[model samples]
Target: MNNEEKYKKNIHHIHDKSYKDLYSKREVALDLFKNISNANWSKDLKAEDLTLVNNTYITADYEEREADIVYKANINNSEVVFYILLEFQSSVDYTMPLRLLFYMCEIIKEYAVNAKHKKYDKNVKIPAIVPIVLYNGEQVWDVPNQFRKMIYNEELFGNNILNFEYDIFDISNDEKLNKDALIDLKNVTAAIFLLDQKMDAIEFLERIKVIALYFNSLSDAEIKAIKKWIKNTVVDPLAESAIKILEADKREVELMVARNAFILDEMRENAKKEGREEGIEEGRKEGRKEGRKEGIEKSKLEVVRNSINNGLNDDIICKIANVSLDLVKKIRQECEKN
Candidate 1:
């Protein structure tokens, strides 16, 4: 696989594991919710009351896409569902609002089906849904956050149109995160997002230290899991090697030496690969051009032979077939000999 595809796969794996293992916990999920929603709703919520629901939703066509997390919680004495969409793509998806809308619809539809089987009241209302997008992409998300904002003639529809806006926690821009106030798990999550961005091995090691400090409360297994995740997802060979080495014990100087060596090796390999690909592409283009030119020349020769058989003179055949007089005379001699 190409480097970009490998990076994307690693990101997906890390996101899947982190959200399932850590963020699915009530305390961690609640902290993340509070940070994204900017609401003081945690005091009212008991950890036991928050339930993590299955986030895999199938569309009408039976195609499935897994959401990061879906939490069922009681907020303001009413049932509310939080749909957390973890976006780890390098580029911003402009259709995110529509995509979230479809997911919400599917969730509501499933809830309705279950309610029917339970024989709930016909007048029962659907729970409020809070769509949250946690994006750690390289590019800033510039798309509109609301479903209605995506419509071209949204203003013309006025109040009759349906619209919902999702909350976004853009981790690419550090301004969005309150680094000081975040809990340990949330801080670790932020550190993971920051690690996704481009950074040298030394810088990565420093970030790892910050994550390790916050990870002190967790079990050794948990720390090991995070380290393994770092090793897998990091694109830089030096960074990956450093994580593997640093996991056993924090050795900064050794990590730096490994990183420097990795950088030189990586540069050489990348240059060689790019040169080979360019050369191959150029060769293919030239081959196709030559083949086409030869085919056209062959076709002209056949036309010249046919003209000679049709009793056309050499001068006329040369003009008609767009060939030189000497070439037409050579063809005439070959035809006469045959």
Candidate 2:
């Protein structure tokens, strides 16, 4: 499709990979459940208590499906599995409860096979599973958490119908679990949650600065992983040139944050300077010879072009340059050709 369409798809993929990578860390996973989950038992959990369950199993349809973040933990002397499904769609998925049910079934099937359990055996006892959906979408999540809600005449069926509810943490829309709550936890996952939210460049850089303070408790490897996640998820997709600026730093997390801030500030200044100079020249030609409207249009075009060259996306360019979406797309096409 078009660049915009590709960018949107790429963003979803990047978000998936980035979150999976982050939660791959035992400490990050531990922090996520501890800080985010409403379950009171999570407060006493430790990194050593959680074990990552890595398995690739075939679905009922014979398609290979790789499990994302499944963790096995013991709580109150009982085995429990936490299956975390990371969702980053811009809109809500109506079939989320059904999807989670299918995934949970797969997980349980795998567990049953591994445990050598027989159906309806006298000595068989299945471990409890706590399915959780972590959604970071912009839209409000209005979907029912209970699987029975998807079934018609569920109230009539009552106890006869199989009903189970998954815990959902709608990070963006949930008022009780917003960025402020995450920041209060002072963990790497909290910083990640904040950075993942939608914000402008200046605010994002400021957030990077605030996020650096939370890294003091992280190990060297954890710090490295967080930096790489930030680069891959945020910088590479939006401001490509910022990666070069970040690469110039060989110090610690604070220095990396400083470099990111510096990069955005420098890019902003350069865009302003280039837009002004180009606007003046264009205005000299168009304003005197033609009209004031032509000069203004030329000025906005210069800003849009400069923004695009600096690796800013169309949305940001449109806002900063005070130009129409059509104008920005047209200028982007012209720039790509040259």
**Best-fitting candidate, measured by TM-score?**
2
Give the runs in model 1 whose Cα sits over 4 Å from its true position.
Answer: 1-22, 25-27, 35-37, 58-67, 75-88, 117-123, 178-186, 213-225, 235-338
The root-mean-square deviation over C-alpha atoms between each candidate and the true structure, in angstroms, is 18.5, 4.7
Write model 2 residue lDDT over 141-188, tens digit each, in one string.
899989999999888986898888877767667877676786677676
Task: List candidate 2 segments past 4 Å from native.
Answer: 1-4, 56-67, 75-91, 236-298, 313-319, 322-338
Compared with the true structure, all predictions reach lDDT values of 0.59, 0.66
Clash number for every model?
0, 0
Tell me the TM-score of each prediction against the true structure.
0.58, 0.75
Instruction: Write candidate 1's Cα lDDT for 277-310 as tens digits.
Output: 5555555777755655555566567667765664
User: Clashing pairs in model 2?
Assistant: none
What is residue 81's positional error in candidate 2, in angstroms? 5.6
